[model samples]
Target: MASSMVAVGLALAAAGFAGRYAMQALKQVEPQMKQALKSFPKTAFGGGFYRGGFEPKMTKREASLVLGLSPTANKVKIREAHRKLMILNHPDRGKTHPDRGGSPYIAAKINEAKDLMDGQK
Candidate 1:
């Protein structure tokens, strides 16, 4: 297996398609990643390396529903909901509190939902 991977690597390097192949592999692994990478500008906003953007696909309504908030929910309500949900679902909390098994994806989704809602307001 090691030798096969080394040979593949050498072949890709010789073909001068290593970076492109790697990026293509990344695209396959993460279907949603292509949009973010495709939108990159030549330079970053703060005059640094342009780290790619992370635009979540969840719409405002979807995000609000995920957080159990109404579409018209204000920032305070959103903030409170996010805090409560994070505490209840956080991974660290799982170790300390078994009843609440840590859910990293839920936490991340909650954050994305908040971001989507926040941007609208």
Candidate 2:
């Protein structure tokens, strides 16, 4: 009877270990499956638009307005406009003045404008 009990106990331990290993394997596979799903191309048939390889389009007018400069403005004027706009739209100042709503977007737009204008020169 003691031998039978030992056998049963060993069997139970082995089963428990197998179960734990199976669970871990499943856990690892779940993430890989999720990653594969995410990497899959979005399809219109799946009720999703293709977001892959798409970039935001910017226009010269939008850039000039963002930097607080006229569209006809030159490189030197663009730089000056960006400087002035940055002073008002800086995120640090927005932190102190909660009404400004943390002007990071404006700051980014200003930087984009400067980059576009500088590129044109």
* Cα distance off (Å), candidate 2, residue 110: 0.8
Model 1 / residue 106 / CA error / Å: 0.7
Off by over 4 Å in 1: 1-56, 96-99
Q: Any runs in candidate 2 off by more than 4 Å, and if so which?
A: 1-55, 100-102
Best by TM-score: 1
lDDT (Cα atoms) of all candidates against the true structure? 0.75, 0.74
Give the lDDT of residue 74 in candidate 2.
83
Model 2 agreement with the true structure over 1-121: per-residue lDDT tens digits: 9999999999999999999999999998998899988997653335353344313765776675556556788888988888888888888885755997437876886787788877852
**Against the correct fold, how does model 1 do in TM-score?**
0.48
**TM-score per candidate, in order?**
0.48, 0.46
RMSD of each: 13.8, 14.4
